[model samples]
Target: MVLSKVGKKINDYATLVMFSHTIFSLSFAVISMMLASKGSPSIHTIFWIIVAFMGARTGANAINRVIDAEIDEKNPRTFMRQLPQRMLKKKEVIVFTAVCFLVMVIAAAMLNPLCVMLSPIALFLMIIYSYTKRFTWTCHLVLGITSAAAPVGAWIAVTGEISWVALFMGAANTLWVSGFDIIYGAQDYEFDTINGIHSIPARFGIKNALCFAALFHVVTVILLVFVGILSGELGVIYYIGLGIISILFIMEHRIVSPDNLTNVKIASYGINQIISITFLIFGFVAVIVK
Candidate 1:
């Protein structure tokens, strides 16, 4: 009975953090790690990278939920979330977040001195992004930066140094995330405007926001092309993944519009997941072939 209760509670926390959504960033991180290692990272490195990502993402998500609890309660679309629905207490979530961060720091320490030094900065970026919506319409970009940290940090973990290739990977991730985020934010246009929560959609309207998203995605592809070139390792397979990603991005935009955001979830979540996984697979193949 106690075990079952514990299991359920663990599941609840996972749901609260949207744990499965880790795929979105994990794929990019893994691809970056492989590139940094020239397609041959140690198992130990891989384990710690995965641990760090899980800890950072889960903690960041938990804290975001706690910080935005009241706002989420007021937003019709988010009112059913764990916090707003009383599925998780504020203190419980806060404690969980702290534990997750501790795990992240420990994982970083296990990796290298550089990763240890950078962990706190990554944590700060992740935490600060949640509050950006209250003050700036650039919140989506802030979020993209936070998400980009995953790939950049993974690259550093492997090479123990920064490189242009890593920066290109980070930039690609930043623009890709920011683009889809603009589309996702459109679903909350009404709630955000009324609540004074800044977002591209709230500030510029959905139609214009989608346009900006498309532009960002276009740059995302270009930056990815640069990443391929800069690495001097990735090849046809990587570029093929980019092509598929471009098509997926187009499909993402086609399903939603200012007048009809009913499929926003599919566009922002489902398609992005496929894109990430597709990139991860093809990137690995390219790396191995080289």
Candidate 2:
């Protein structure tokens, strides 16, 4: 029974990490390679970068879950989380977080000196984002910027310097993430308000929050366009992919209304996944084809 309980706890922990979007974070590393290489980065470099991204993301998320245990226990949608439900002990999470952070640091060390130096900053921002909701509705933006760090970090890992193109990609991702996060927060509007937590939905209400989300998405697209233009690296394929992204964004919004949130999952997971994968593929193709 003890072994079985441990296995269940491990599964629960895995579920939490998966939901934290570690895969999405790794995808940014892939996109960064696409942007950095004139053609393609070495397979070894890609491997290490992916490992670092995943480890860092996992560490950040585990810390967030541990810190938010109290909040999760009070929120209906989150009360069943591993930590809140007592499926995983606090000590277990602390050890896991340490392991994840160690792995990230080691992976970053293997990548490059720049990546190694920046790893702490990236981890710091990731960890900070979870607490931002306690004080400000701008938490979503902080989370967005945290996610954006993946591509920027990857770019610096490869080039060992900052570039305007990389900054543009980061900005574009920031807006994209912020927009979707606002939509996702809609589900917790009431809970957030009651708990004195700040979020766009809690502060502005659903309808206006959705409007802000749309506006953010528009800014995302504009930034992406500028990135393509400034890099001069993308071709017709990239534009086509961008068009598809636009359509997906539109469909995502159409499915979710202020009064009806039945399509929340579709908008959040379905369309966002499509957008990320599209960016990865097209971004890679543009570099390779050029």
Candidate 3:
């Protein structure tokens, strides 16, 4: 099959950004959209929301990869990534990022005036996160806040406003994501430390960093419980899901310590995939079965 130029670009961009990971925050976005619409978002809203999400996620990842290409090249684990391997050029990535962000802008404009109005702030958050790791160990939190935008934006997209419910969900997502990031970043403890990159493990030592991760996840579960209580939208099923997710979070922390990162990828990527998917499933069921 002959691939057209655009088709090749799509393939490259997909590989460049590991587009599969879009599921992470997208699950929350979907949940927020469904809850905001009382379980049935219009197809039009759903379509545009998905488009906006894909663009934002891809654009953010591409930009991050570009910014960290040199760092990635130095780290053995990331040495083979597209940017570090030179399979994708920085200029190409910049163009792709620009195009993806434009898609987000277009989608937001289609959603509502408020969404359009807030698009720049969203973009700014995404862009600024790439720099955070350079200066702060709390870069994980920055990334979480950026990731949380998915759900919050979806809620705003659906209702054309924000609420404590969206904020709660965002906070839950923030801690959930940040906790996992601390775990994942621990895998690069040596590389980050040797290179002077600011990361939880690099700054606090891996054991204490894991402690921070555990603390963050505890807050995550609490915030989620609050979401269930405060929103009154999510019901017992979502709470049950949160309970299961809490167990998973505990397992995630237990299987990996600073000295034993053997299960780090499993805890971070494999189980994390299940966590997000579970959220999507139970979140949907909570709304549908409510």
Pick by lDDT: which candidate is best? 1
Model 1 C-alpha lDDT per residue in residues 65-145, reported as the tens digit of each score = 999999999988889999999988999899999999999999999999999999989999989999999999999999999
Runs in model 2 deviating more than 4 A are 1-10
Task: Write model 3 residue lDDT over 1-290, tens digit each, in one string.
Answer: 45687787677778888888888899889998998998989999999999999999999999999988889899999898888877778998999899999999999999999999999999999999989989999899999999999999999999999988899889988988898888899989889988889998999899999999899889988887887787677888998898888888888888997778999889887888999998889989999998
Residue-by-residue lDDT tens digits, candidate 2, 101-166: 899889888878988888888888878898999999999899889888888988887888889988
lDDT of 2 at 162: 85
Model 2's lDDT to the true fold? 0.84
Any runs in candidate 3 off by more than 4 Å, and if so which?
A: 1-11
lDDT of 2 at 163: 91
> Which ten-residue region of model 3 has the weakest summed lDDT?
1-10
Q: In model 3, what lDDT does residue 186 have?
A: 91
TM-score of candidate 3 to 2 decimals: 0.96
TM-score, predicted candidate 2 vs. hidden true structure: 0.94
Note the Cα lDDT for every prediction shown.
0.93, 0.84, 0.90
